[model samples]
Target: MRIQWIVSIVSNLVSMGLLVIVMGQYQVLNIQKQREEKLKTEVQRLANEYANDDLSKVTMEKLLADGNKTMTELEAAMAKLSPELEKKRKDVDACQAEKVRSFFQFPKIITLTRQCLFSIFYPIHTNMND
Candidate 1:
């Protein structure tokens, strides 16, 4: 009878330990399921936000077509005005060169003016008496 009582006590303890382990596993699985649900909700929200954006409404092909049209128009304008632009650039360069030449010739111009004034004031006497 004593042996039977000992065996019964050990069996009861083993059953309680298994029950505790099963409860722990159930709690872990419940937490994991909650985290997965939260991730799914976040993904859904991001997808909805992207779908509602203005850029998403415009198609890629349409955007490319508009860009190509603008580029072609700009190229045509540049081709039409290329010769005029080159002529204006040449005029600007000629003006700049003339400005530099005038600056360098300023001293020579003053010296020539002085020589002309002296020659006019001191005329050489052709008659020695008068």
Candidate 2:
């Protein structure tokens, strides 16, 4: 009877050890599954962020293209009007020169009145005319 009792106790201890090992393996497998799920979620979030970045880049590229097109059109328009603008600028310069000559030839009273009116309306203070 004593031998039989010893044998039964040994068998129970062996079974308990096996159960502990199995439970440890199950816990490890559960932790691995949780880690895998976390990594998958992170990957999805990063994918969404990258997708938004790509959309922003595309929008910026389109805006840049439109801006460049507008700049080109403006440059072409300026080019077409450059000669006319230059001629007008030269005519204004010649008229201003004639006015300066006439102002010097005029009497002091007329010169002062013209200068005051020119100063009030045009506001260009050239040292030669001042």
Candidate 3:
């Protein structure tokens, strides 16, 4: 009778251990599932935060307005300087034509003067040396 009772108690303790192990595994799985759900919720929350029309539209509008203002200012500056630029351009063209004429004429004058000097001085030099 003593051995039978001891055997029954030992079997009960083993069965209790198995039961605890099973419950612990189930708890772990439940915790993992809960964590996965929380992560999913957080991702959705962040997605909605950016996907909504909260700041994107306002920022784009502000940027476009600023760009338009800048473009208008740039156009105004160009318009104001348009006449001055035109005058400068005409002056540059006249100056360039004058430069071309002077360049071609100066070289011819220099060559002619050199030839005249050589023709006049060679005889003078030869007579003087003799």
Q: Which candidate is the best by TM-score?
A: 2
Across residues 1-130, which tens digit of lDDT does each residue of candidate 1 receive? Answer: 9999999999989989999999999999999999999999999998888887645556766888899999999999999999999999999999999999999999999999999987876575434446
Ranking by lDDT: 3, 2, 1
Candidate 2 per-residue lDDT over residues 55-85, each given as its tens digit? 9999999999999999999999999999999
Which regions of candidate 1 deviate over 4 angstroms? 1-36, 49-54, 57-66, 121-130
For every candidate structure, what is the RMSD over all alpha carbons to the true structure, in angstroms? Answer: 5.8, 12.5, 6.5
Misplaced by over 4 Å in model 2 are: 108-130
Alpha-carbon error at 51 in model 1, in Å? 1.3
Per-candidate TM equals 0.49, 0.65, 0.56
What lDDT does the true structure give each of the candidates?
A: 0.90, 0.94, 0.97
Clash totals, every prediction: 0, 0, 0
**What is the TM-score ranking, best to worst?**
2, 3, 1
lDDT per residue as tens, model 3, 80-113: 9999999999999999999999998998999999
lDDT of predicted model 1 = 0.90
Q: Model 2 TM-score?
A: 0.65
Clashing pairs for predicted structure model 1, backbone only: none
CA RMSD (A), model 3: 6.5
Task: State the TM-score for model 3.
Answer: 0.56
